[model samples]
Target: MIRASGISLRRGVKVLLDQSEFTIHPGERVGLVGKNGAGKTTLFALLQGELDLDAGHLSMPESWRIASVEQHIADRDRPAREFVIDGDRDLRRLQDQRAATHDDDGQRIAELEAALLEADAWTAPSRAEQLLAGLGFKPEEWLLPVGHFSGGWQMRLALARALMAPSDLLLLDEPTNHLDLDAMLWLERWLVSYPGTVLLISHDTEFLDAVAKAILHIDHHKLVRYKGGYHDFIMQRAERMQQAQIAYQRQTREAARLQSFIDRFKAQATKAKQAQSRVKALSRMQLLAPLKEDSSISIQLPSPTYVPDPLLTLDKADLGYGSTAILKNVQLMVRGGGRIGILGMNGAGKSTLIKTLAGQQAPLSGEKVAAKGLEIGYFAQHQLDMIDPDSSPLQHLARLAPDVREQELRNYLGSFGFSGDMASNPTAPFSGGEKARLALALIVWQKPNLLLLDEPTNHLDVDTREALATALAGYEGSVLLVSHDRHLLRSTVDEFWIVADGQVQEFDGDLEDYRDWLLSRNASARADARKETRALQQDDSNSVDRRTQRRQEAETRQRLAQLRKPLDKQLGKIESQMEKTGERLQELDLLMQDPNFYTDQYKDERPQLLAEHGELSKQHTELEEQWLDLQEQIETLAQSDH
Candidate 1:
């Protein structure tokens, strides 16, 4: 359906892509995989004619219409139907003009008729409604103003528009970025059954593996096409790289032997001919490129000073917003060293309940408490907001943690990729990946007994994201996580807590199984919702019950506003501590350099100095334990509410 031959995409001197050759057959489902800046989005733009490639021929059927899902959506005040139909901007504009004026002139009338027929203006509303409904938007929500929705819902509208149009090929860029678990599964099914060709770029590994029949790897300014699933592609790349390494090694050995032969035999004419011929052959041989082996990302989480035995407990817990509660009369006992996954849709009250579990917020009209040793490390989804860009990591840490030594602090920063000069750089200029890494490293450094991570992998590169996941999996403490990254959830978590429309569903299984169950339950949930909506509409009152509706809506919106800040502030303490410790560690390094400094200190201070150091260590550990306990408790609460 689409083909890019010798395609080279560049901006000024920076080459985004170079001579990439690939072909997409009609009705093919292809996963475009690459690193963060490997031009997956840029390639899609070139094919859609949104961006021009530097060189090469891009050929596809002239009649084929292409659709793309843009990342950002602005001006969401219009209704869902109107926003989707607006994709055909010219048609919508002409219709607006026609509605405002009584221009019976032949030129305008004929033009309007032609445009209306081509754009399917009369049926656009029906199509838009159906597409939105299939994407989980309700019939009642069809008329709701888009301005009321959050970023996640706005993304859904963009995707709905993209899917609404009849296109021969679809190019989706991070289409599942803000999607919850259920919505992601629905999209996977749609892609699997879609009639047109699909090219999807996403960070979701499981989603890619589930839907992609072929993998198109964009790497090192070239295209590495593999004709199979994502797993097949991984193995293929590994094998290809291995073979190249072997060939390169063999060639290098031959080159060395030939050079040695030339050095020893140049004086003998007969032997010289052989040596010279070998040199020419070496010149003709193209040097095998250096092997680009995939680098593994590893992190060493700081150990706990004092672990909590019982993380959290809830007896008859009624968690929700206001009196119209969500999960009611529930009992849950969460022990320490727990690893839990909170799964649900956008308005599931997962956050509200989780906060209650953390003891940072209270459950509505219910009894909830935590163990004494509970130290929580709550990492909110938007945790980076607490970090100040103006200060250096060192300065930030010094202000937050007074007891940390300078040399120890630098060592912590070094482990997280901020070695030497990088640690001294202003944090304001840090990329999203760097900031995310700093957040995770900082929190883990404090050695919290329980950790609550909310959407930690959103803007991270695949390598860094997986590293974070790996570290979390290896953590000895308890954990509660709210994330859309299925790979991370599946690999790291053993239990699933699903939060849906004002109810929580707990299941004992891996993420893969949970996904299967969710897909099955989704159809049933839709049917029940539709039936309920119809019954409510029959009443002389509004479409949905006002009290029930307000409670449900407020859980997501109002609670999001209240808790986003405090949780982020709590988690930022780790980075704050790390920065201080780094500075202290550096200071100690300087002092230790002077051989007489330790001897001089010992002369004045003996037991008191040693006692103070012990006290600092004891304080740091106690704080970490409390932070961890709180984090786990909150996470457990999130699961229960879900």
Candidate 2:
């Protein structure tokens, strides 16, 4: 167990943790959460012994091994797998000793070999490869030089290295920031199964919920611990705050009564003793600190002046860079008020699709039609780099709307948490979260009819992420979101588009279903690989004739296709019904949102409308279940064919 008693930490004059004490038991996965500048990293540094506590006793097991991802890695021509394997210092030390041994030292060599076997040195390469694979590196890339990969890929490599190391405790900071949905899912499974304590800091609520057994939140320079995952912590914290508020209110009433009595009767001879006693009592009373709500930032996207239905259309388009088509024969339509989430593994052309739609890249073939007065608010990581570092948020907004008043621009920036000096200061010193907010502010200022966001929540903290979700939810425009933040995806997108196998298509399921599909697909691939290896080792003479084998395979495929045709037809019918039911639900939702819908004028029609809505909703759910069942069956048949 790790314990901190009366720990007080500071950076210069700013106090981060003052007399804060918290204990984390062995094997507990704890999530550390706070605002962007709330000293979470400082706490991690203190735990790592990189910083000294100004006042406190911090203790942990002296023999425990700790592992964390390195923020910087030397650029070198080292094989990625080798780099990861190097994380195991013990194994490396054993290998080094063996290499330095003389050939005549047979006894020492035997002892070293036994020690190597004890340490499982022989399997280190495979273990390293597994970590690399889990972090989204392809098998072929395992042997590539670490320097050959881009910075983001290098970060993934660093994460793999950390995971490869044997340790009693692991510290992960935003581990999923550089990961895709598939990689994030893989990492979650790995972390959950890890037999070690983990202290993680992440803005991803879903990730926290999946991996954390407890939450350690920084509230007002104090460490507060809550049991269970992030969601449970949220509920528990809210209840605690509510109870605190009630206590505070009761205390206030009592204090006021005592003060009132003392004021009214202190001058009277008859009640002088009582008044003095009350004053003494009041002076001795301990005052509870008032609950101060943290100022939450919010954004308001200006409504577009005009919204055209079917805002953009891609017809048999080939989306990619230069001559290579990452997404072939893509057919998609973005209509006004449509909210879409893009889902895919890393390197699966999700960004390419978004870029193509945003007009950052033209299609190699086929037509991309845009409706008149079309405006797109495109945001990607690269957009942050486009911001003028020397200019203030006000200046950036002013450039977009030169005719708008300076006060109005300042007010607009304030909504994004850029108030006073922040709005006027140059953006060079701003943190990633601030820069992301500014980029979004610039995008919102345009009042675009369509929002094309690619990982907009990457650098955003939990509160800012919630604010963005809220703004996107209420915005009167179409949205195409590409993000790994499941919470944001669930809140902002109504439908999903999956980019996979060089094609983009509608996914008829939610994020959970996508996860299941990915798992099944990976399993099938492994099985196929095993089968291929077995076939390769068989004698040629024992194998069936090539023509006969081909004929049998063709027959099997034909039978499977014949069996699937009816099911496919039925699935199509169900999908059409679901679409109609979904449209009706949307219509009902719009009607219910109207304030006048509950008025006396429409009182008689309300019941009928609600009843219809309930029936449609039930029907939609049934259709969805059926759709998922059929999809699973189709996928099974497809896997069998493979």
List RMSD in Å for every model shown.
Answer: 32.7, 25.7
Quote model 1's TM-score: 0.75
Q: Model 2: residues >4 Å from true position, as ranges?
A: 264-276, 533-642
State the weakest 10-residue window (summed lDDT) of model 1: 559-568
Error at 281, model 2, angstroms: 2.7
> Model 2 over residues 1-642: C-alpha lDDT tens digits?
999999999998988998999999999999999998889999989889899999989999998899999999985688999999989999999999999988555546545665786788979998998898778787779999999998889999999989988999999989999999889999999999999999999999999999999999998999999999999998999998999999999999999999999999999999999999999999998999876667899888889999999999999998888899889999989988999999999899998888888999899999999999999999999988988999999888888889989999988899999999999999998889989999999987878999999999988999999999999999998999999999999999999999999999999999999999999988887688678767876765367788998998999898667657666878889999999999989999999999999999789999999999999999999999989977876776688687
Q: What does the lDDT come to for candidate 2?
A: 0.91
lDDT of each: 0.75, 0.91
Q: Name the TM-score of candidate 2.
A: 0.82
Q: Which has the greatest TM-score?
A: 2
Question: Which pairs of residues collide in candidate 2?
Answer: none
| Model 1 clash tally, residue pairs | 35
